[model samples]
Every structure is written in structure tokens, then in C-alpha cells.
Target: MTIWEMLAVFAAGIGAGTINTIVGSGTLITFPVLLATGLPPVTATVSNALGLIPGSVSGAIGYRAELAGQRPRVLRLAVAAAIGGLCGAVLLTVLPPTAFETIVPVLVALALVLVVLQPRITRAVQRRRDRDGRTATPGDRGGPLLFAGLLLASVYGGYFTAAQGIVYLSLMGILLDDTLQRLNAAKNVLAAVVNSVAALFFVFAAHFDWTAVALIAVGSTIGGQLGARIGRRLPPQVLRVLIVVIGSAAILQLLTR
Candidate 1:
């Protein structure tokens, strides 16, 4: 890569890491940047997945305080995410590049819709909880329904992980009966597992650009820390709007290309 390209990819990584830590659609930032740098679509996706792993880990660790007492919840959800992620990685390796290119725009659009509707969904959940006379408590452990929902989400995460945190947050908010903060902490860990597991598969079986990986890894690590500090401070409506704008841009980029 040229120096300019390297700088661009690194910058994209920082943005991705920050967004991923704050919300969960960092791939939308990095994947397009990698493509703009002249990598093939499949190669860019694989490299992006591998490159973002460190940032995911960093984001998860940044939420360690919120993760407290959620070991059983995380572990249970992790198994489903791992299996789904492995399947997704295998599919990515075997599928034609045209398949990914054709489908990704649709996926990004769907993710955008989810991000836009998150607040409405949260309110609906709150109403249901009120009607049911239930309150979020530390003792809540999500059951089979949540596991199934997470498995589906993880499969998508493995396949194409833009705005995946939105999906997780929505599901957790509706099903798990917890604060958004705690659910977000769980989302980070599950997202990390999905990405890390898929990255492992891609490293062994797929094509990737190592220079891109290195730049993204370093930049994303820094972004993750910053996101942990700054993302929490942003108002929910503002963050939702940001996610919509970014996701919409990703869709436009994909469709135009």
C-alpha cells in the first residue's frame, strides 16, 4: 500500500474501532475504506474482519465493569455465537465474491433500519415490562429464546458485521430485562467472539492484506479506549442518528460501487 493508502486505512480503523465500541457497526467504516484502497471485495472483508479483532477485544475489556456478574450469560451466549460465527466464516470462504457484493447492500440497509428504530423498540420493551410488572435485576439470565435470537444475530455478525451491536442491543433490551449498559457490555463480548472466531478461520483459509491488518489493529485499539470514554457520554438520540447516517453512507457506497 502507498503511504496515503496506509494512512487512510489507519484512519478508517480508528473510526471503526470507536464506532464499534460505542455502538457496533465499525465494519461499515473499515470495509469500504479497504475497498477504496484497491483490495478485492472478499479480501477486504476478510482483512477487515481479522484486523478488527483486537479492537473488539479492547472494547470488551473497556466494558469489564459492566460485564461483572454476567459470566453465565456471556458464556451461554458465546457458545451459540461461536457456532454461528464458524458457519458464517465457512460460508464466506466458499461463496462467490459476487454473492457478497450483491447481498451486502441489502444487509447494510437492514442494519440501518434497525438502528433507526432502536429507540421505539426500547420504549416498547419498557411498556411491556411495566405491564408485566417486571424490573431489570442482576439475577436476570436470558433463556432459550434469547439464545436463539443471539445465534441468529451472531450468524449475521460472522457473515457481515456492520451495525451488529444494534441488533444485539435490541434483542437484549427486549428479551433479557437489563439496562442498556449491561446489555451493551454483553454485546461487546459476543461480538468479539463472533469476529475473533471468524477471523481465526479467515487467517487460515482466506486471502487478506497484512499491512491493512496491522494498521487497523493499532488504530482500532486506540479508538476502542476513546469510544469507551466518549460514546457513553453521547445522548442516545444523537448516537442513534450517527449510526443511521454512517450505515446509510455504507449502503450508498456499496450500491454505487
Candidate 2:
């Protein structure tokens, strides 16, 4: 990669990691930047999975305070995430570029819709809390459902992780009993698991764009840590809107190209 590309990817990593610490759509930033750097679609996607592991790990650590009570739920969700990651990686290696191309539009559209609607859904959840004294914890009826969502999200993460945070937060909002801060901690961990295991598979089995991957990983690590440190303080709605806009433009560019 050129020095310029390297800087761009790394810078994106930092921004993405920061955003991911609070919200869930960091991949939306890094993946497209990787593509713009002249890497093939599949190579960019695979290397991205590997490169962002550190960022996720850092975010999880930053959220350590919130992670304490969610061990059982995290572990159970991780099992399916690991298996699903492997399956998605295998499919990625075997599928042709045309297949990936066809899927990108669909994935982006799905994420867009989910991102658009989640606020309304969460607001409904909040209204429930205001009206009734009852509260839902992560381990309640929400656990199984959220776990299932994680597995599916992991599978998609393995395939192409753009708006994955939407799915993660959507599930966390339902399953977790902890404060939003704590549930975010859980999001970082589960996201880390899915990315870590899948990244492992890609590095050993798939040829990578090491230049872009290295830069993005380094930048994302720093960004992820910084974001985690101030996740709650960040203007998350502003960031999410920015993500949606940037990600939407990337999809349009890809389509129009």
C-alpha cells in the first residue's frame, strides 16, 4: 500500500474502534477504506476480520467494570459465535467475487433498515420501564433470544461486518439486565470473540493484504482504547448518524462503480 493508503486505513481504524466502543458499526468504516486501497473485495474483508481483533479486545478491556456479571451469558453466546465464524469463513474462501458483490448491497440495505428502526424499538423498551416497575435482565427470557442473535450476527460478521453493532445493540437492549454501560461491556466481549476466532481462521488459511491490515489494526487498537475510555461521554447518536451516512455513500459508490 502507498503511504497515503496506510494512513487512511489506520486513521479509519482509530475512528472505527472509537465508534465501536459505544455503538456497533465500526466495520462500516474500515472495510470500505480497505476496498478503496485496491485490495480485492474478499481480501479486504478477510484481512479486516483479522486486523480489527485488537480493537475489539481493547474495547472489552475498557469495559471491564461492566463485564463482571455477564460471564455466563457471554460464554454461552460465544460458543455459537465461534462455530458460526468458522462456517462463514469457509463460505468466504469458497465463494466467488460475484457472490460477494451480490451480497454487499443486501447486507448494507439490511443494516440500514435496522439502524433506522432501532431507536424506535429501544424507545418502546424504555417506555415499558417507565410504565411498569418490572425490568428485564439479560438472563431472563431475553438471554436465549439474544444469544441466538449473536450467533447469527457472528455468522454475518464472518461474511461481511458492516452494521454489526446494530444487531449487537439490538440484542443487548433486550437481553441484558445491567445498565447500558454494562451491556456495552458485554457487546465488546461478544464482538471480540466473533472477530478474534474468525480472524484466526483467516490469517492461517487466507492470503492477506498485510500492509493495509497492519495499519488498520494499529490505528483501530488505539482508537478502540480511547473510545472505550470515553464511550459514555461520546455523542453516540451523532456518531451513528455519521456512520450511516458514510457507510451509505460507500455502498452507493460500490454500486455506481
Candidate closest to the true structure, highest lDDT: 1
Per residue, candidate 1 scores C-alpha lDDT tens digits across 1-257 of 89999999999999999989888778878987898899998899889888888898888888888899999889989999998888888888887766655766776676567556666776787788899997766647667887887887787788777767777776776666556677777888898999999999998999999999999999898888878777667766676676677667767766776
Q: Give lDDT tens digits, candidate 2, residues 1-257.
A: 88888889989999888877776668778877888888888898888888888888998898887787678777877787787777778778887756655666666666666556666766787678879977765454355677677777778777776666656665665445445566667778877888888888887888888877788789879988898878755454664565467557647755775
How many residue-pair clashes does candidate 2 contain? 5
Model 1 compared with the native: what TM-score?
Answer: 0.87
RMSD (CA, Å), candidate 2 to true, equals: 3.5
TM-score against truth, every candidate: 0.87, 0.80
Residue pairs in clash, model 2: 24-165, 137-177, 138-175, 138-176, 138-177
What pairs collide in candidate 1? 25-163
Candidate 2, poorest ten consecutive residues by summed lDDT: 170-179
lDDT scores for all predictions?
A: 0.81, 0.74
Model 2, 61: alpha-carbon shift in Å? 0.8
